[model samples]
Target: MSKSLRTLLNEIAACRHCVDNPDGTSLPHDPNPVLRADKSARIAICGQAPGTRVHSSGVPFTDPSGDRLRDWMGVSEEQFYDVQRIAIIPMGFCFPGLDEKGGDLPPRRECARLWHARLFPHLTRLDLILLVGNYAQKWHLGKERKSTLTETVRNWRQYLEMREGPGYMPLPHPSWRNNSWIKKNSWFEKDVLPRLKVEIKKRL
Candidate 1:
């Protein structure tokens, strides 16, 4: 890793402010977070927090979900791990623990506020930012978003209708839960998937 990357990681790890709770975590989170690459990355993959496996392993997208993500992007494991080509930055840095229903909870509020502004400056040559999941979409799209995620994604064209170059593309998290949503939204299969593959091919 470069000196700048190492310095940034240390800075993030050293930050102790409880911007979300102020009282501190009941179950403390892994403050040290992994995000993006060392400045040469062209594609940025922004998703939700790290899952259990990811947190434990300290490698993003090491589970089945990552398999699906790689498949969607039409990239091999070698390419996906190449930080110079693909950068992985989640909305939340640490694992936010589980919910009452046994599902993973949402990302922390403080993360984006603390890191995004700091990190964005370093990504000088980012060509495509893959906004995976609602959290990323909300941050990037903001007021331009519709009432719901489905609506926002359905109207994804609005984000690209006016711009050129490999711009932002919002996607649902490639978890098992979204399989039904993917099936229901035929346009994803007919329109988005094909276009996505074309984009990946161009980058590769």
Candidate 2:
């Protein structure tokens, strides 16, 4: 890693807000809540918070969701993991504890507030940004998004229609919870996926 990136990694690894229940209390490990990026990357993938597996590994997208994401992007493990080609900065860097409804909780509010601007400048070569999940789309595309997550993703072509530099493309989170939504939104299967794969191929 470059000196700057290595320094940033040390800072992230040393964080302890949510991770250091040092008093042995009932609280959880919610450390620094977002990922950092290298300065020369070309493509950026923005997702939600880290899941349990990702947190444990200290590597972004190291779980099933990541597997599905690679498939959607038509890339292999090596390609996906290549920081020079792709950059991943989820909304939440640390694991966001858990939800009462049986899934991981939403990313902490403070993380995005603190890190996004810092991370954006480093991505000088970013050609495209794949905004995965509603949180990412809402924050990046804002009112340009459609009525719902499914609609917003289905209308991905609309964002592409903008044909601008920030070349934003909205996508559903690859988590299994979205299976039903994907089924209902077949246009995504018929239209978006193929186009997404094509764009990824072109960029990579």
Candidate 3:
């Protein structure tokens, strides 16, 4: 039989593959795999790898981006972090480090290859998964994903309407850097946020 979710999480917590084996270059810093996985949760906030702030905090979404994501979902801080209600599963469990431009590098490929397929199957109560950035959308949506993030997120309704499996909601990353994109995409607030709230409320 497969390992229990708790056991799997324990293994993941002590994971050193990124630094020991690695995908390409080992992580620049010591490995700090940051993610949350609770079997009781009904919704999973699927996001990219941890940034500097999250890496330091070790708690997921403890940054300004988190505040915006909470607003987008119309939930309070308490509601967002409730382990029984919401799960935070990012593409990469660790901080993949920064590029020369100072932007965070992409999520480590090792993370998904090693853990995602194994972990997701254990989340039996999950009703929805919010694909919260390009990396997440790409991995989860696969060949079905649209050519661009905007297109994938714009077609969010289709993913939610699926007859089988957890509903998927594509959302842009809520980083402060995306403020310009958010301003440009007025319909996201006018059209998407209402539906997102409705879905969240239903599951909670």
Which TM-score value belongs to model 1? 0.89
Residue-level lDDT of model 2, residues 66-184, one tens digit each, is 89999989999998888878888888677777868778877765556666766676577887899999888988887888878877887777787676665878999998988998898
Off by over 4 Å in 3: 1-3
Clashing residue pairs in all predictions, respectively, total 0, 6, 0
lDDT of 3 by residue, 79-192 (tens): 998878898999999999999999999999989989999999888999899999999999998998999999998999999886789999999999988888889998898999
Q: Model 2: residues >4 Å from true position, as ranges? A: 1-9, 17-27, 30-36, 161-164
Q: Quote the positional error of residue 140 for candidate 1 in Å.
A: 0.8
Displacement of the residue 185 alpha carbon in candidate 1, Å: 0.7
Q: Pairing residues by index, what is the TM-score of model 2?
A: 0.87
RMSD of 3: 1.7
Assess candidate 3 and give its TM-score to the true structure: 0.97
**Which numbered prediction scores highest in TM-score against the true structure?**
3
Order of models, best lDDT first: 3, 1, 2
Candidate 1 residue pairs that clash = none
Give lDDT tens digits, candidate 1, residues 58-157: 7999999999999888889999999888888898887777988879978877788978887766777777788898999999878877788888777766
How much is 46 displaced in model 3, in angstroms?
0.5
Which pairs of residues clash in candidate 2, taking residues 3 or more apart in a chain or in different chains? Answer: 18-29, 18-30, 19-30, 33-93, 33-94, 34-93
Q: What is residue 129's positional error in candidate 1, in angstroms?
A: 0.7
